[model samples]
Target: MDEILDVVSLVLILIGALLCLTAAIGLVRFRDVPSRLHAATKPQVLGMILICLAIALSLRSWPVVAFLVPIVLIQLATAPLSAHMVGRQAYRNGTIDRASLHVDELAGSSETPPAAGG
Candidate 1:
């Protein structure tokens, strides 16, 4: 159904927009750098991805679909890597506080990640 598909696409777009809004809020309210980076990177990337998908579905042409798909794929592929590298660099540089970090998932991280100049 065209109407159903349109509604679904619209809803996905709205959900993506909401993800972006929450990401912005998290970026502002979060206490430290690592969390902020997580907030800014993951949700925003997902939001854009949803947006791209919405555009692709709406346009429904091979050229447009082909153009949008790889951008989404590349972003989906690379965003986490970018976030990990940046987060690790932040941790190494001491911009993130262990006290504020609820989850420290990175392997071989310092037992006590040094403070911003320790």
Candidate 2:
């Protein structure tokens, strides 16, 4: 059972690493802030979860997992929210490319730039 769990943990870690690699690739391929944010958030949260799970498994005990639970919980809750907030701010600020987006709720509603009138 312990060996089986170890193999599962290793697989999870590998999958998590693969997700991170995908996110890295996405950082180059994605043309805009929201798209890049989408790529980065999931992999980061999942990677941390897998890493913690791996640590818990390697210990082969429950006590370590208990400690890990809050960490994962905090990340799971906050990571996506933070990513969304950042993406929203970038969109609002017009930092993201318009061409990369298929639909933007705030599109065309961006604040007008102030004139340099004396």
Candidate 3:
């Protein structure tokens, strides 16, 4: 059982490392902000979770699990929110290519509101 746990932990670590590497590659290779944001957030968050799980498993201690839990939760909470904000900013700034999006829900909305005093 101990040996099996060790092997599983090692495999998880290796897979996590590979995912992180792919995220880095995607950031470099992707042409647009939305794509870059996808690459930066999705796999990166999953990779972090996997790595943390492996650490917790390898350590096999309640204290280690306790420490890793919040890290994973915070990452899960923040990554998508940050990615959405970045992508929205990119769209508003015209940095992202409009043609690449299949469905644009924000097309009809104005970028800025009218002045209240007027």
Name the best candidate (by lDDT): 3
Candidate 2 Cα errors over 4 Å, as ranges: 99-103, 107-118
For candidate 2, what is the TM-score?
A: 0.76
Name the weakest run of 10 consecutive residues (lDDT summed) in model 3: 109-118
Model 3's number of clashes is: 0
TM-score rank, highest first?
3, 2, 1
Worst 10 residues of 2 by lDDT: 109-118
lDDT of 2 at 95: 92
Q: Tell me the RMSD of model 1 versus the true structure.
A: 4.9
lDDT of candidate 2 over 1-118, digit per residue (tens): 9889989889888887887788888888987787788888888778878888888887877878889999999988998899988886797776988677777777665674577231
Q: Tell me which of candidates 2 and 3 scores higher on lDDT.
A: 3
- Quick one: best TM-score, which candidate? 3
**lDDT (10s digit) by residue, model 3, range 1-118:** 9999999999999999999999999999998998899899989989888999999889999999999999999999999999998887788789988887899988986355576232
Candidate models: Cα lDDT each: 0.82, 0.82, 0.90
The TM-scores, one per candidate, come to 0.75, 0.76, 0.91
The clash count for each model shown is: 0, 0, 0
